[model samples]
Target: MLRTITIGSCVSVQGLLVGQMADGKVMVRVDEKTYVGYPIPSKRAA
Candidate 1:
């Protein structure tokens, strides 16, 4: 299934999680970004 996986505010309007990188950093396509220290859920499955 395809679900919207967002990094809260760590991404931008032009950013995208284009698969994961080798170092675990999500390959995002963006110019600048904003970071928000929010609690991210570990799992969203119910």
Candidate 2:
């Protein structure tokens, strides 16, 4: 599934859901890189 995550107060990233971290963060892949950041709940989930 595709998800969005916030890396900072103003930075947000959108990509395919990779995996979840134990610290509550989620991993996302935009192209070839994977980023781990705090997840922002999607509208469907909220």
Candidate 3:
């Protein structure tokens, strides 16, 4: 199933994947909350 995930902190999801930083976790933001996850990124944009 596909879903609409939000940008956690300021990490780049479509351009950059700078590995954990100040926002040391990948997460899903919805309704003012964050949920950590190991995003299985399919492909990146140009």
Candidate number of the best lDDT: 2
User: TM-score, each model?
Assistant: 0.27, 0.84, 0.32
Model 2 CA lDDT for position 11: 93
- lDDT for model 2, on a 0 to 1 scale? 0.90
Per-residue lDDT over 1-46 for candidate 1, one digit per residue giving the tens place of the 0 to 100 score:
1123345655323344445546444444444643222222348578
By TM-score, how accurate is candidate 3? 0.32
**Which portions of model 1 show Cα errors greater than 4 Å?**
1-14, 31-46
Q: Model 2: residues >4 Å from true position, as ranges? A: none
Ranking by TM-score: 2, 3, 1
lDDT of 3: 0.43
Model 3 per-residue lDDT tens digits across residues 1-46: 2323235545433323334435444544445554554455557698
> Which whole-number lDDT from 0 to 100 does residue 16 have in model 1?
42
Where does candidate 2 have its weakest 10-residue lDDT segment? 37-46
Clashes of each: 0, 0, 0
- Native-to-model Cα distance after best TM-score fit, residue 5 in candidate 2, in Å: 0.1
How many steric clashes does model 1 contain?
A: 0
